[model samples]
Target: MHVTLIYFTIFFLDFVTHAVKEDSGYWRSKARMEIRRSLSYEWNTNEAKNVIIFVGDGMGPNTITASRIFRSGETSSLAWEDFPHVGLLKTYNTNKQVPDSASTATALFGGIKTNYEVVGVNANVPLRDCEASLNTDNHVESIFSWAQAAGKATGFVTTTRVTHATPAPLYAHSADRKWECESRMPPNATRCKDIARQLIENEPGRNIKVIMGGGRQTLKSNVEATESDPLDAWACSRQDGRDLVDTWKRDKSARKVKFAVAENNEQLRKVDTDQAEYLLGIFANSHISMDWKRDQGPKGQPSLEDMTVKALKILEKSANGYLLVVEGGLIDFAHHRGQAAQALRETVRLSDAVNATLQIIRTEDTLLIVTSDHSHSLAFNGYSDRGTSILGIAQRSKHDNTAYTTLSYSTGGPNNYAYEITNNKAVRVDPSRFDTNEFTYSQQAAIITDEAYHGGCDVAIFAIGPYAHLFHSVHEQNYVAEVVAFASSIGEYGNKENSASIFAVDCILSFGLFLTMLM
Candidate 1:
């Protein structure tokens, strides 16, 4: 009986080894298929009639990899990963190595590297310098302005407040990104306008065909809380007593243009794209709930995917084409709170939005770019097995003999050092005792501080459609705006004179290369 059992054990081990080895052929075949696809790939050089940019805030390399593993197994890829052109962007601001959303947004949209915490203005204007920001020489126009000048419909969508830093650069020129409303502005700064006020009163902002996101509190006047006014319960209304929402509606009405204001998911869905010349959606008083916590409250807010699809419907009505900016802004918020689960889920939500856009728009005439403003300090550590859960503990620390999560921040989190005094000495707490995969679980961090810091590492840029090949190498973050301008024949590259100059330069370079070959 003992001999028979030993032979059976040996047979089972052999079967398991052979089963695992069988996957090698599958991997080799998949690699060969990818090579063939690359060889047959063709560039789309058509003039980009429509431009859509997706910004995944704080989505670093570590975040992408972990999210990929979490959503699918180790070998799978996100929707944007299949983009033909991939590049790395230097995300440093003019004044800071590790950048903030405002400066990075300025670089990405305004095509200039500006001072940290400043948006839609040049580096000459320091942070919170209202006087300098008011100078016309210091003002920088973004791609939205260019698109508007070219007669293209312009719009933006985000999971954060519409006046948030990532979306602010599109229209609002602010010395301080924190000035979301008059309430947040300094008392002495009478000349400078708040970001929310700029959205309703300024040029490009007033002209935007679609404005969808949160910040009802910033736009509405302060009112007494009542059961009938559920939205005002969480509201910190503007101190100016001016309801920008009402102002926006009145402005649109005065222009004699048909417009719609949607306050919830149902209202947004009911908007008539064919008739409404403008659409403004404010679903939350603050930043929209994270993907994990979305739709769990009394009011229903649209998902990122939901907002993207609806925005595309309205923008597609323009004859001269359109420019749409969509931001997965909550990924950064989740990372700031050290919630890796929420961050990864937010990334997946972004992926879903991208996929939804793909289904609605054709790549032939549209330029779609996906990138991040900055990255977080989220670190993916350990050598776990292939099938191990991304949120699960990878291994026990050799030093303390305590288990650690695979996903952890490099520094700054509330639950950084979970420990107990056992022999009058602190020891690392084992995370395996509780459900680390829980959406609320705070990932372990190296040090506890106010929040996790933004990483200085270069972020990834993925592009598809017209002139997407422009992003085939490393570049400064500002290069993105230049490529969009060139592809769409807008901004500095819009005129025939500039196109002629570029053609002349190309011809000269070709002639030089021909002479060198003869030599």
Candidate 2:
């Protein structure tokens, strides 16, 4: 027995030694490289001509760390991890400690913290109060409106419905986030327009150069399931019977602007971005499927990276620059279902989209901000080996000798009750007996509930390009919109006279420093 134990120990040590590249010189060289880059860094203070904000709906610090490990290895970094500026955002809304997407999105896009379930409106309007929402004084403008007012183009892309909570605040003002269509609204709320209608009839929405993502059923009238409407056969139709898609096309036609619509991947690829001034692409009836599932489904939908590249191609034609919002919306959905693997994969896809954008845009003129609307309850646990798989088991519990995964949630999930009552004591089911890396597998949770909840922790922010240095410290969530507005010289902070005055002062200070250096 002693000889066998000694042989197994030797094998384990040898495996670990080979798995990790732990040469002291390797780490020292990497540290020196990072130091050299930092010492030679120069701040970009140029005025931003274009802005792109990439939001991972439920991606928190923990999720980012796990994704970095899953995508490459323990020491690997995501695309945005190399950004020069990093900060933390306080994501609480006025009404809740642990906020939802709607309120947080409103803060990020509208520059104000509002109540939960509210969008594009101030805190003065109560949630679900249709009369309160109709008051123009209670409404707040977003970055999209600012961009349009400044003669800059604007657009958005998401993995979920275009009118979903995370993207709705950019163009829609509603008392309730659920009011995506008239059918979803209460009968008494006749004065309030549905989110889809706002996107078609409102100022910034109607003028938006590009719109993509799901929610076809909300935009069209009642129709039977056909080859075209395969995904949303059971989805609820618009109660107003007005085809918003047709409305959008007619409005654009009246203005005599070049416009195009695409319902599938092939149609989208066929669009002439150079000629089309307006574009709309809706590939799913509701939220788009998870990345892996979408790949296995019909070949109609485009990946998030594909949509992002197309949007940039169209938006880049604007001579005055553009403001675009891209969302990895499915990360939140996957976390709610307790699918840690799916959530991490979605985060990686968001990173892929960011990398693609970096390839297409010039960082000298464009400001790119990558952040999260909120965080999930997903927790990273366990003391695994040097190069253990992120989805594999960590260590066994000493109390019961049951294996637990590296990723688990704080509360709620299908795996919350994954135990057996034996002899009046519960024993956690051994995860080693099955494949925990399956896409459908749910990580264990601390408590049993219908769904996992959002975490109250602050999320991370990464910035590059012009004015990136503004995000060097912790800040409120609304600071994000403020930075975008200030950098692009748009919104209330963007008057020609004020900008000139600030520029003059900067020049005076710069000249004084130059003279002192000469002395």
Candidate 3:
């Protein structure tokens, strides 16, 4: 609703042209559809029963725009773009201009910005020095903890390992994000705990109703891996000789807690929500496969949409409602590899997960937020035709008679960095050597580096439901957690008028969106 119309003029003209050619009644039909939206746009002032946050890692404005273009050529929007409230925020960390996931995710979930590589701890804690963080006094609790204390079921789902930086802050507290398992701890940091141990043994962690994702090796030994022995050829393996997965199951059995564990998509689908009190699903020994590599057979993990649907079913069992975080994390990794085709496909898969979540819950009482932790340096260039293939070469660079695609990154990957540095992209490359449209092909980059870098730019936050209007202005990244806590009537900002304020903002934002769409 708060989006700019100028940026969408191209899309608007395309629709109008089609309508005029199809039938004279098409315009009238479109007007009635807008009226229906106006009716469905009412704001509910009552306390929200649920809050879901959908995060797209490394999704920036450039990333979104390029993805929109590549998805179907002329389309200019995704599912979240239709939301009633949208705004941009600065993503800088307290100590660095371009923040990493540890600090940025901590700010979003803990409501306090800290130094780089610091997760679920305050700014007073130094990065990677666990000796200085041996005590519990330095731990910073995230919003998930607040939800648990309030008697609400809390959970998180991501394509990355549940012990990864983003999800770790939701439940685990450590001096460093890299301390994923007991064996990974530094020599002098044995006094402290690893993130995986904390997740299965600590407060909010043990109490969580659902924990799903990859990281089997972080808990089970590499020898026990089901899909592949020693699992992904690219992932780290556990070497501590302890089977924490079995230990976790033993603890649950001794406590008489009813639980279900699934290793593949088929097993997860058979879980009966009515009978199971807890669910644990780990699909890979490391991070789950990317969208291109996803196979839903007996040996494969569930897709992002599959995971969201299952998580929602488990969480909705609570009468008090729930708070769940679903993250599409591999967009960052694909970008790191300079694979635009792969990265854009991941974003589309993320959008599919968001749409699936919407089908299970009504928007009137639920607060849904879709955003990114940070951005990559990927961008689109050249003024080609509106409906031209987004992945097709738009022009032959004057710098060298070599052709270039609309999408390219600042730096990263072998074909991009090494090929460019060695020949300066001036080797009169054969167009047939690589197919930009192929799902596995790597995209192009400008400079040379082993991995792409995060960008120092503002990222957009799209929202719908109560109190979303409070996010209209440009603000610090930490302010997002404050707005979420206020809307849900939790934490320090919980008060008598919280619901009233939320209702008021809903009406205002809906009206603003209506006017913008009319223009």
Candidate 4:
């Protein structure tokens, strides 16, 4: 009986030990997964004292690469490449594969995916529907509005007119993004409403702190008699009838809107920052000219970097930090014109702007985001070495040491010209119907490339500072709003950090996959 009892006791002990081992393994696995989720969730929830979103309108991966080559020469990386974090972002709209600037900018500002050509409204509505009347009228709010509500200073700065689509998303809520300036019949006052007016009237007493860039004429209807509307003839004007400049002399709140209206660099430099909390600076009636065309000293247009730096200086003064939006708005214009040289130069200007902002940002406390709304159908083809001239197109044999003229117009036009169509071989030519005058005047023959004639391609996205890692993986255009909201430490996740380099790993994997395919 004693022997039987001992064997039974030993068997029971063994059973207990085995069960414990199995349970421990299962718990460990569960714990590991929980930790990963926690980290990722936190990675999406970091905060910053200031948020700076730098937009390179119409920029793409190739555009960034070419800009890097242009700025640092063939071998150097872009200034922003040194940012400690990086991530990819998608630029698609809900209804269209190819998105317009209006809807894309709306995604960034409103955190909602919208359809093409629509602005500040959700995607479900009909194209002809007005955004102001949509049921979502109050449900969808812009980042600027959120920042304002949070008591943080907010500003919008760009090379485009203040009323343009890229900047409109921040302050204006409208169905039609093209509502630039309203007009009426010859006898009547311009009765139509525009986005610019909506922004100015949105909040009567709240001060936005800093409003800069071109668009003087859009704001004023009344002016002293002059060649142009005397009121708006200045680079900047306070059309609200408050005479913010005079108020700056007396009233405290009016003084807060003290502004500088400069049409050139000279006027920009003379503004007194010591006296004003809110500023309005316009350098031109429309978008500023290209950097190459701009003059230096008092006459030249300000570089994107100059505008960015100035904007930060004003925004950082807020005790509660600030949200600032800066745009290199002309890169899109260059792409629309199919001028590669102009587009590349504008991209370099954007890189310079990013570099300037990063220099001022010390704490991983500030979140800096750089991206484009969508990509243009642009590409660089042909096999070339590192130092090969990007300006010229030459084709070299993939495996052998032979070279041929790789860049020429399939339409039998000059290489310098841009045509609308491309042949079966991926060569470009102008569509027969388009007037020659419509294309920019070029002395050289036009080359037609298949890629140039089409649309719908992935754009570029890059970010740094807290929670920026959340931008990784395939995501929607609204993901940008999520990332910004997360990084601001505003919604869902808050005060979390991502030190795991998961995003970095993903980037590496993507690069390797691309190289593997090439091999």
Candidate 5:
């Protein structure tokens, strides 16, 4: 409700400015610059102190557009609509036109394009097999790594496996990005150590204060040690027999790391943030369910919003501030399913998470950025009103009649099911209503696409907090690095000192006053 009111207030202010400009030709000339300046003042700039980045995995432009219509009652402007800055990011790999999770995440966190399957390393050479692992040693330092080195508390939270692509590369370095655990993706026993083991047992103690998400099954064994999984032998030393969780407990450096294994939301909510320094909450055995199925979340599962809020509470305690990365990991799952309804629903969930984050952000010191690594092919089509349903064909009218679908599927129907575009813009409830139990929600509305597979669509990014103005162009993926580096006062090469330039410093102070009138 607060977010909605805030958005409406901003809209009204923008409307008044537009009206004034229309009445005065002279005022129109300065409108663009004035708009930029007004936006520049929307946050407190005097004491820019922290940085938080929220990445909606696989959420592109089409995803945000679709989500807006569902979440806002009617589509007008999104919460991020007031951001004066915008920018494009490149997601292509050094070897392929399309990139995978490992390389895409590596580029975002590591700041260099790597091979399709590599993590935390640059792809300098070509012609490597798809499965060939890239060495992660000596790569660009991750933002989390930098934060830890600078004496700031650093943490990772996600709906995906904690060691998954997006969060793993931040602290773990390995030749094979796919190796999730010492037991599953074991290191070459003759050549190297296990990345998963290093992630828990080998890193400098107390660096990662909080680690949350799923993949616990991969970290533990049903019984204890055996010759079959020698890693289990080490696990047997602990009562729990979970290598990752147990190892952290045994390490003196991590004794201060507050650990919690929340299999459900109830436990998550009860977690005492004050006492927790290093937290590990794996809410699911695998990846947590998407929002559509979130209602069916496990007995104690925590909503993504709950986890994010808890994470912020813990990170905010640091004197030097902290770096926290929260991932809406289910958006990618929705896209992979080619279920637009679920995709949009989850995007709305992501928006709710964003709203919650903004609630606790007190100063302009924090830079809050929301973006996707790449895009999918899905998009908004046809001329329709704000609340028009995106699930079916959109029809145009000629005097008194409706038009037919300009786009639709070619195959897969009972009697070659043909749909018509209509002014009946009622929201669709089910996309697969008629299909058998083999699939669910057939009647639910969804975007019609050429393939049953996901496409490359443009991703949407919204920002309002500190240094967000830096992201205002259609540039490459590495642009995010520049924005974060500037916001956190970290240098590009990881050795430079933190400083807020004139614009950055001013924006910080002005944003507070601007929100009073504008928000």
Candidate 6:
């Protein structure tokens, strides 16, 4: 009853707001679009020529439910939630029960469960042990290598730095997830390579046709203030005096590989993806701004939707097909800071990116999978009224006459250095005074610790395309790569080299066997 009342109230409010601002045609058009979306659903069983994976870094079931309820009382579903195949992915790493991005990434992209904090390596290697990583047996191939080997274009897009844990596993094999640049690497580990360097120097990593995200500080010898959002600047500037971006450009030039770097909205608009086979766009120095707040700053950042469309513009040029991975990685970053509003906005941005990408591709021929690297510590509690602002305090706790937020994290960043949110004796606030819906709002966190840890829940994987039905059962996270590999006929699953001829002979033998039985 409470939920129904809340929905009706929100719907009425929205109607009034739209009545004042938008024309009647807007309402008619929106209804038509919604109907079209429902009618467009189809069982795509055709062999996938292209594969696109969208990773919502910390989106667990709780995150999805919270997002849905927050938007309105259960009336809306995320764009990808309607996908034909939804599976629960077991995310425990090879060593740890609650895995981090690097380990989970190796499982999803490398098709193997690796040790915690290690990226693109098998379980044979230990974390941060530089020497152990040098063994050839420790190295593991990723989706990028398999795609490239099969003569397909490959790329990845992320809200985090391009060399961050999630995207790094696509091409980089690092002993330490912290080894993003030379400055992060130890002098003793000379043989071990950092992520940014490997991204430029390694095989399939260097050969990536579309690389878009932040990490300008890691790529440059000196960090310059860009008069935009200060968050775009990184604290750990490269001290080695080697400009990796310049080196990358020189290498591409020497090899005659066409590439362009689109660093901002203006550049992104100007980059002619058709003229260039390779593109690298780094918009920020560290991680990019949160999606909703991105436009508020003077610094121009392209929306995830814009970046996805641009990537497809280039990757679509490949006649053999392409493999692209998109990461809404900042959702995890915000959750660690105990920022619920930011996380929800990032998740919404990812959904919008998926919806936009769907507009440009044929669903039957494109295998699209949406999943998360791991779950966050964000929790929803209290007997909050349904439709209570997701970030608002549920009416004061009758027990102590103190109010608590409907949304909160279990732990926080160093005794809540960034923001304080304690459970037992939390500072109460009047929800009426504060705008909980603000994008910059950081929700309350229950515990006071150093960085909220990942939750040990099975994140969801939503799929649409050929063999998507294979994801019907609950399975280990590594099965993700195996299913995609088999569907696309790449890597070890590349039995298609003579599969057509074998099928024809089997059919002929079936017919000939009938005559032999009669004889």
Would you list the C-alpha lDDT of every candidate in the order shown?
Answer: 0.87, 0.88, 0.79, 0.62, 0.60, 0.81
Q: What value of lDDT does candidate 6 attain over all alpha carbons?
A: 0.81
On residues 1-519, what C-alpha lDDT tens digit does candidate 2 reach at each position?
A: 232343344345444644668799756865775676566557888889999999999999999999999987776678888787899999999999999999999999999999999989999989999999999999989999999999999999999988889999999999999888888788889899999999999988999999999888788877445543354433346756788999999999999999999878888889999999999998877878789777433356888899999999999999999999999999998999899889999999999999899889887889999999999999888798868889899999888788999988887666655677889988787888878889888888888788899999999999989998899888999999989999999986579688678769989999999999999
| CA RMSD of all predictions | 8.3, 8.8, 7.2, 16.7, 10.5, 8.4
Which has the higher lDDT value, candidate number 1 or candidate number 3?
1
What does candidate 1 score on TM? 0.90
Misplaced by over 4 Å in model 3 are 1-44, 224-236, 418-433, 494-519
Clash numbers, per candidate: 0, 0, 0, 15, 49, 0
Give candidate 4 regions above 4 Å deviation.
Answer: 1-46, 131-139, 184-192, 204-206, 221-257, 396-454, 491-519
Model 1 gets an lDDT of 0.87
Distance from true location, Cα of 339 in model 1, Å: 0.3
lDDT (Cα, tens digit) per residue for candidate 1, span 319-426: 999999999999998899898999999999999999889879988899999999999999988867877899999898888788998898887667655666889997
TM-score of each: 0.90, 0.90, 0.86, 0.70, 0.73, 0.84
What's the TM for model 6? 0.84
Q: Which stretches of candidate 1 lie over 4 Å from their true place?
A: 1-24, 223-237, 296-298, 500-519
Give the range of the ten consecutive residues with the poorest summed lDDT in model 1.
1-10
For candidate 2, list the clashing residue pairs, or say none: none
Superposition TM-score, candidate 5 onto the true structure: 0.73
Name model 6 segments beyond 4 Å from true: 1-43, 226-236, 296-299, 414-434, 497-519
Q: Give the per-residue lDDT of model 5 (tens digit) for 342-393.
A: 6667777777777788778853577777788766544455665544455544
lDDT per residue (tens digit) for residues 1-519 in model 4:
232343344345434543565477756864674455334433424367788888888887767776766564553566565443566657778888778888899888888888777657776654545533245543356788767766788987887877787888787655566655453111232333456666665551135677777665565544343322133332333344543323322443444555555556777676666655766676655677667776667865677887777777878888888888888888876665555567777888888887778768753577788888877655555654665555444454454433332222222223345323345453333322222222242212334442232145666566666777776666677778766765675443233444235456769999999999999
